[model samples]
Target: MRIAIFGKQFDPAFDEYCLALFRHLSLTGAGICIYKPFYEFVSGIPSIKLNPDSVFKDHADLPECDMLFSIGGDGTFLDAVTIVRDRPIPIVGINSGRLGFLADVSKDELPSALNDIFEGHYKVRQLDLLKLDTHIPAFGELDFALNEFAVAKRDSSSMITIHANLNGDYLNSYWADGLIIATATGSTAYSLSVGGPIMHPASKNLIINPIAPHNLTVRPLVVPNDFDLTLRVESRGGSYLVSLDSRSCILEESIELKIRKADFSVSVIERNGKTFYSTLRSKLMWGADRRN
Candidate 1:
């Protein structure tokens, strides 16, 4: 089996765990490749050997692999998605940061989790991604997001008006700081923080949640995933920010934006009876109330 590890910068404290993961994988006799920058950083540490031939600097240089290990927080997992870019490789996240809602695997569970993969005791689950259709083409070929595609006012002191439609039918004009079109996989992310409901990952639905709406009655709406939505934003600053997961870019006012489910879904590896429900209960403290 072939596996590649991808991540950004690392915290010094987590270096041992990272080294341990690589060492354990090496013992399995699987071919391994490390992201070039991470390879450089880890090479300086004592007793670490990273083959120069087994380094991938960018997505273009990354070889085909059975699995890709994302070794950071949820944001790094999202970055890994951009690297995969419609590829069928199953991704598993090894969380080394806080609030790992997406990157659920903890450092303590890394060894056992990897063993599950090598022993063929893991499940691959398909996750839907949201694709953005815009004339601007801000994100190049990596325009899809596993979490959400958002539009927000560029000015911190001002709000924006987003006119939205569902299949050419008027939805609503959102007067708020921003608007989020989040997938089921994203319900727990920025959407949740802005008063959106937590949705089951398998649910065939998309959520439209306003960020700090001027009107309190403007509530979040759930729509069928099949619907193609269009949005036009009016901002006082003459521009707005468009973000696909962690990648953001500026857009001019009145640039119409289109969003729909992507043609391909991302495959994520799940192991050790870690269901979405279990993650919710543990991550969100769903049933931890003292009165209960």
Candidate 2:
């Protein structure tokens, strides 16, 4: 078996775990490749010897792996998406940070989790993602988001107007702080903070939520995921923010972004007993009503 590890390498916990994970895999005979960021920061520290398992400067240096280990919080997992976009790689996240909605594995489960993998005791799950296309000036198609695509303001004092067309038909204009076009996988993210509903990851819905809309009557909208949606935001600023999952960009006012489902997904590996409800109950304290 082959495995890949991706994350920020400056932290002490992560550096220790990298050695432990590598050593654990050493016994199992599974080939391991540590991402470059690991050694880039840990350089000159006492060298950690990796036998059958090894460290790599880039993805190309390592033998193709079966699993990709994300060794940080949710943001680290998000960063991993760029490394394996559209590839059929399975990711296992180790939560080394707070509010780990995406990073499922805890610090205590270290070597044992790899043991589970060697025993074939894990499950593979298909996750959904959003795709973005653009014809606006200085923009192109084929961008994607495992979480969300949001158009937000670059300045503090002004609002942006987002003109949206759903399924090739005109929809109401959104004049607000910004707008969010989130996938079912993203409903819990920024979209949720802006009055969007939390959706099941497998649900066939797209969430369109406003960021501080000028009109109170304008509510968050959910549409069938298959619909063709074109969203364009017009603003006068140095640069407007266009985010694809964890990756973000700043563009001029002449650009537009069209969003829909992606052709491929990040195959996140999960343990047998893990469920969305369990994450919600434990991590988010969902439905913890005080008035009950």
Q: What is the C-alpha lDDT of each candidate?
A: 0.89, 0.77
Predicted structure 1, TM vs. truth: 0.95
Off by over 4 Å in 1: 289-292
- Model 2 RMSD in angstroms: 2.9
Q: Which stretches of candidate 2 lie over 4 Å from their true place?
A: 13-16, 42-48, 51-63, 136-142, 287-292
For model 2, residues 1-292, the per-residue Cα lDDT tens digits are 8888777754564667667766677777777677776645545346456443567654346447788888788888887776766677889988876677788777777777777777888888888788888765323333777778888998888888889999889998998888888888789889888779999888988898999998999999999888878877788674588877766778877776778888887898877667888878867887789975
Span of 10 residues, lowest total lDDT, candidate 1 = 44-53
Residue pairs with colliding backbones in model 1 are none
Q: Summing lDDT over every window of 10 consecutive residues in candidate 2, give the lowest-scoring window.
A: 134-143
lDDT (Cα, 0-100) at 271 in candidate 1 = 83
lDDT string, candidate 1, 181-265, tens digits: 9999999999999989999998999999999999999999999998999999998888999999999999998688999999999
Give per-model TM-scores: 0.95, 0.88
